[model samples]
Target: MSRDIHKKPFDEGTKAKLAIFRDYLREWLPVFIAKREIYWNTINIYDFFSGPGSDGFGNKGTPLIILEELNPHFDNIISKKLNVNLYLNEYDQSKYEALKKNVSPEKGDVRPYSIQIENLDFKISFKSKFPEMGNKGNANLLFLDQTGVKHINEEIFSKIINLKQTDFLFFISSSTIKRFAEHPSISRYIKLNSEDIEKTPYHKIHRLVLEYYKSLIPQNKEYYLASFSLKKNAGLYGLIFGSGHVLGIEKFLTTCWGIDKERGEANFDIDEDKIQKGQFDLFTNEVPKPKKVDLFEKELKEGILNKSLPSDKAIYLFTITNGFLPSHARKIIAQLIKENKIQKSSFNLSTKVCKSGALVTQVKPL
Candidate 1:
């Protein structure tokens, strides 16, 4: 059985993971709240594996974090006349009782939004609440902080994929998959071959697991997925965030890149970029970009010069699909124009650029 984390203070890895969760929710809430009536009439937030509200040291867990983050938005939510619901579920009985006590209104937990705490199994709770999530006028955010890798199987994942106007973040122990690649229990949920696991490097095990999940996405779907790996001693764990909208992707990427500027994907240097941090080229005496940045810029330059990326919209899609922020693409565009390799054109590389009827300018390659 997995160890009880609430029995002890949160370690560094757990703290980092919760920080990202908090940051992303901080970015997510306002978007749907501000869109009230215009796009969505309701906002639903679900935390499937919310713990006993905190660890042994009383640090806030996901459930408490959600409430705390939403506190400031109460006035806005009330003014906009939007309906916001929070569904927090914990499977363990002891934790469920503790969760109730922690967030009880008697303890000054009064708030503007509606909240429901459940002690049912995750699959059951998910099934009961999915209809509300699938409603066209509701915007949803789902958090599944499962103890192990078994909860989010292919069936549940497919259901999540089909939901519109929904964003999700789930935690997984990628190191477990790497350590037990050939084990029957692990293979029951993940179909990755042991040989492929052996080929991947230790730090990138999470990325490999993410690729397996990405393979499940249907060929025709336009979904955005990103990951942030957290390393605790020798063990590797991570969060996989998914959204079907460009704005959702932009907000998530913004939160991630804010935490990790080097790779924008991890707590530690997942790409081992320390060696190149301040290295200057002997010939030009200029600092070299990190490997990931250098590779992305090179690809963007080639695409523009070859006319493959011919417009602002195409470049915006390419930038997001390649796991980059528009600012990164903007830098390359500026450089290309200065070099006279591409003619200057008005560029509106943003989430709005992909909206229906948004103007897109052509990139004239000289």
Candidate 2:
């Protein structure tokens, strides 16, 4: 049998990162559901590349992070005998053996979840398990993480993705293929993500891969991409994610987008806005046409001048409520300042970081 090429069990640093994010997700989820009661079997998590429960190599894997995250929520999860249902897929025999030991209780049925594990390689049976993932108003959050992309075909992912309520967070290692892209033969794997096979170039497989993944989802929904690196050669890998609802997007951002204490120096950590469709087109070279943002600011300027807002403080209020970029909003303020529609000596003179978090100074003069 062909062996699955992969990243070995995680180390302590990796585990710690996982724990932080797991906790982050859990924190947002409750805040996400604050308006609604969680019905039975309404939530689920799918750890597709789940390593064994522990690394013994001095790290806890996803299983450990997941269990730890779930443990606190156990009471709410337990409906009669069932805690929450966890589906764990680990291909390695050694890892599975380790997981079996860690996941079981020392005594009775003290565990709060219903779990199913497949000890075979994830590639061998990942597609086959789709139907079993099931669905609800909530969903199965599948973590299709891997050391690199392999054995993934569009058809296979479509099956997993077609689950009405299912969303995916994929670990896509982009570094490996930059060099490999020179050879057309090595590009077939990239084509697996193709949107339209007929239109795709046999050479530009990476484009196809992205298109295919996008094709698998319902459009007009938000998705996200975040990158992490072990070293320079470690390359950029995208953690691409999708969700079907706005509330999920709101929950995801509130937790994952750690507050930028300094602000606007780095791109607003819009990474947390998961349901946000397409990324904020960051300016490179020449500032790419401000598109939607420039226009939005125009409206904001009009609103500010005519006293549509009580104060420039109200402008910040608009930003907080509307989630507009500080840069974009600042453009609106800059225009208002130039037009002389709104003057200095209006609001507090000092705290002039405009409502959008971008710098625009229309401070009232002393």
Q: Which candidate leads in TM-score?
A: 1
lDDT of 2 by residue, 44-63 (tens): 67777887766565566677
C-alpha lDDT of residue 291 in model 2: 35
Per-candidate TM-scores read 0.96, 0.59
Clashing residue pairs found in predicted model 2: 83-112, 193-208, 193-209, 194-208, 194-212, 222-275, 253-272, 326-356, 345-364
Residue pairs with backbone atoms closer than 3 Å in model 1 (clashes): none
Q: State the lDDT at 86 in candidate 1.
A: 93
lDDT of each: 0.89, 0.51
RMSD of each: 1.6, 10.5
